[model samples]
Target: MRRSLIALSLAIVASTSLTAAARADIKSPVVIATEGAYAPWNLTDSAGKIVGFEPELIDYICKRAKLECTIVAQDWDGMIPGLIAGKSDVIMDAISITPEREQIIAFSNPYARTKAGFLTARDGKFAKADGTGSTLVTTPTLNNAADTLKSLRAKLSGASIGIQTGTVYAEFIEKNFGDIATIREYRTNDERNLDLENGRLDLAFEDTVVLMPTVEKANGALEFTGPAFGGTLFDAGSGFGFRKGDDELKAAFNAGIAAALADGTIKALGEKWLKADVSP
Candidate 1:
């Protein structure tokens, strides 16, 4: 009887230790990478703190998911490569979900939906490019804007356009305008905007929501031109990116994202930060 009791006690202790180990694994710190320079999405304050829409959104997500998350600044170019190399466990920048990117990494359900457009000098020749305020979805087909696309191509022919490197917009611009326009790629949007503002570039293509703040800051110098682009060409929307096999983490984040959407946390935050309804 005494031996049996001792054995039972040992078994209980081992089970408790295993339970604790599993809990520790679940509660371990998750490193989240972001392009901290992307203003209003995730930017570094003058005090070196990462504060913006994404960081705040992730804060709610980490809480709901019971994750201990730490956000760190990463260059836009290295975001995916660094994640795959184990430098970060998650990416929450405004990364669009495209088929090309899905081939490399998995993504959580989209949290925000936005459209891309062109930003040019308000008085420039391309200032009033075709199809302004119209919407175009490039997936499935481009039939909707066949005429508008043609007009834009003709109007911007031989123009200099600036695009950030490693973006879905790069692919779109290259496929459609690459043959006609002089494509200049930059490592950051601020760099690209500098050239555009200084009249070195004829146009800049980016998310209209993201460019809204830039236009506001540009005062009377800049404005959006042409129709907004979306659909599968831009993918569903912006989502949390994860490694190909990080199922557990991805599931946790997806659940949190769903909850945030359902609870209107994402919607409220979008209005607060972006001043637009970006909820996906």
Candidate 2:
């Protein structure tokens, strides 16, 4: 009996040590990066703290995944490079998952989907264009897409269109309307928005989620014009960006995001921030 009792105690000690080791292994923090300039998705407060939809969503995700996480601000252009350089473990910047990007990095299951459209002054010529206030899911082989593009080209011909540099919006414009419209690229959305507001730009192409708040803040000065576009150039919504080989971290984020979407957490957050349900 004495021998059996000693053996049982030894077993208990080993089990406890193993459990502690597992717990320790699970407690390492993940560093997440975001472009703090994108409002409604991720933005910096006056105090320089990151806040907004993506940040709130990530907080819930971390809790659900039991992950210790820290979020850092990064320039939009440097997000991918920083991840490659090991500066961050995840990026939650409303990055659209496109084939071109898929070649370079992995992505979490998409958490939200939105569309791109034009924001112009209320009295702008394009305000009442044929497809205004409608959503268009465009594809390369779609007849309606070709028709819509042709109409938009004619309507916006010779107009100065502003877009942020190095974005899919630039790609779409240059591919479809480059010969028809004068394209101007800015390094930041704020710069393009300023140009649009000052009447230097006849139109500005941007994500509708971002444009909604801008229009509200502009009162009646600005409005979304032309058809809001999705698919193809816009890709299939936004997901968390990860390095190409980080399968473990990608799985963790996917599980957390799936739970959030299942529980309506993402939709609730979207409505609170964007005044729309952008959950995917």
Candidate 1 lDDT over 77-161, as tens digits, reads 7778777877778887789887778888899999998888999999988888877777776763666767877999998998998
* lDDT of every model, 2 decimals: 0.78, 0.76
lDDT of candidate 2 over 116-172, digit per residue (tens): 898889987778788888899866445568888878889999999998777877887
Worst 10 residues of 2 by lDDT: 1-10
Candidate 1: which pairs clash?
none
